[model samples]
Target: MKKIDNMTVTQIKEYVVTRQKEEYPNLIPMLKEDHRAAVKKIGQNLEKKTAARDQEVQRIEKMKSIESGYYDQGILNIGGIDEVGRGPLAGPVVTCVIILKPDSSRLYVNDSKKVAKKNRETLCEQLLEDAVDYAIGQVDCDVIDNLNILNATKKAMTDSLAKLSIKPDLLLIDALHIDTDIPQKAIVHGDATSYAIAAASIVAKVYRDNLMQIYHEEYPEYGFDHNMGYGTAEHIKALKKYGPTPIHRKSFIQNLGLK
Candidate 1:
């Protein structure tokens, strides 16, 4: 085998990329004491990346434990209920009810707020595709203005639950109780603690963000693509300068003094 000292920098990088922890033992012996700086830097990065991945796996297992407790109780179909856009100044409140298979091993699943925007879309697709049953419900700004955000959010969650083809034995909801005869446990920060609720949060966040992106095409002044109708400085500035769009929640902006 060629020594790392004799290998080109490009070759060293390739080796680092392709190598795994099992090969790390061999790597140490191959490195020369004085000239191992480049290899050491790259190896450190690889180690850090591996460590982060392992940490995420452990966290996912902890989150999955919530569902496992239900599975232990003979509840096969457990649904996760979560909603997005409740605090946004505009756009609709979107909710998702999703039932994932008990044996799901998707490491990327986590609280939607913890995920980057691009990764959320990819994870959303993966979650939907792998789910045993999933459904989305959206309540527009008009309904929010009429019914109030909390009641409208509950409405959206219940609507999504109703749309699911396979009714769940139990619901793990994030913070709010839905008006449903079906059994549910309203968990504070369920999106961070429960795997099922986190999956639903991701789906709901992505779906609402997409809708806001579409709305951005019509109202580019508000920067909906990035802010997702949230009350950001830019959005508020736009609301003051350009006035409210049709999608703006009248009740939400009434205090803002935007007509």
Candidate 2:
């Protein structure tokens, strides 16, 4: 092995990358005092990253604990329900029912609003792949305008549950009760507190975001790719200039005075 004093900085970095996690602490000690500063900076950065990752893992475990007592009682298929696009002025409200395996990775799971878009997309893919059972339902803007957003959201949620391949023994839903026979607990901001609900929220957000991207191609003036059909200034400007599309929720947009 080359002595630390003889190794170039690039070589030392390569050595650090190859070292096992347990070997990191001892690595700095092996370096000469003159060579230690740059290497020490690298070690500090690694330590900080590890600490952040560990903290997130602990949070995920805490969130999963909500299902532990139920699992102990033999309720194995616990689906979480959540929806996206309820507030959007156009496009469909999308709901997801997801039964995440107890052992599925929960790192970075949280309310969809709290996650970055790129991370949400990545987590959505992971959750879908890792889920034991999952389904999605969509209600178009026409239904949202007629039934009203709250009732439309409930219908979408119920539809998602109906489409699940495996019937859930119980449901943990985010802040709304669906019209279903299954036993359920409505948790306010559940996506932020429950692992399963957060997973559902992430999946629903990504699914709706992708839909909006497609809508953007059809209606480039509305900027759906970025606004996701929300009534942003750009969207409102487009509404005033060009009028509502088939996807616009007429009931919600009446206040905007768009003819």
Candidate 3:
């Protein structure tokens, strides 16, 4: 019988549920609609905060997974490896290896595909500043042609691990396991599912985007700045008109009759 204004949010919620089940049984439809609308309004105010907290929890859980592995072996070095530019037509495959602190709080770290370019850039900068160690390795067009994309991707990953300032006891790779003596796990769709892999994905993507932006200045006709070396209609038309640049992967162009 107490007024709604006198009740706490939780009390009000319980009251609403109880009323729906007991006093409002005859008005179930209207009561249910009102309850839903009130719950939605409360959720609207809390959704952003709730999402951030959830992301933090997910990040911590991911870190704990890696930490558990390290703790079992009593070793601290753990690395995450990911690659970008695999599907692009006119750029090198770039891979990044990142050794993060077990308790790093790098914000806005998520799958590169899920983040905007500006956010990725900001995260990349913050990651570089906060990471224990990180390295980038690139395999160019000629190497990609000779070794093929799979092997080239592996090589890029290996090279990135090699360039790391500190050696890792555990390697978390995105999908492809490199041929290495290092202890490694290949996680499918890791960029979306694994925090470490997502961080590495962001690093690799930002690095390759910058590289392609530089290439754009040299080959303005291909629209590398806009498309980032992808096979967009503009890029393909430019290839037909002016032919492939030195940076174009020859193997990819074979299907396009540009060889």
Writing each residue's lDDT as its tens digit, candidate 3 over 72-167 gives 777666787899988989999999999877766666677898899999999998877868999998999999999999899999999888888798
TM-score of model 2 vs. true structure? 0.93
Candidate order by lDDT, decreasing, is: 1, 2, 3
Model 3 has an lDDT value of: 0.80
Q: After superposing candidate 1 on the true structure, give the runs of residues whose Cα lies further than 4 Å from its correct spot.
A: 1-9, 20-35
lDDT (10s digit) by residue, model 2, range 26-134: 6645652435688667656767766787799899888888887788888889998999998988999999999977778658999999999999998998998889999
* Candidate 3, residue 198: how far the Cα is off, in Å: 1.0
Model 1, residue 168: displacement in angstroms? Answer: 0.8
Q: For residues 1-259, could you state the per-residue lDDT of candidate 1 as single tens digits?
A: 4467777768888876677667765664454342668766765666677678889889889999989998998997999999999999999999999999898868878889999988998998888887999999999999999999999999999899889899999999988987888899989999999999999999999888889989999999999999999999999999999999999999999999975
Model 2 lowest lDDT segment of ten: 26-35
lDDT, residue 15, candidate 2: 82
Q: Estimate each model's TM-score.
A: 0.89, 0.93, 0.78
Question: Residue 65 in candidate 3 has what lDDT?
Answer: 70
Runs with alpha carbons beyond 4 Å of true place in candidate 3: 1-56, 59-73
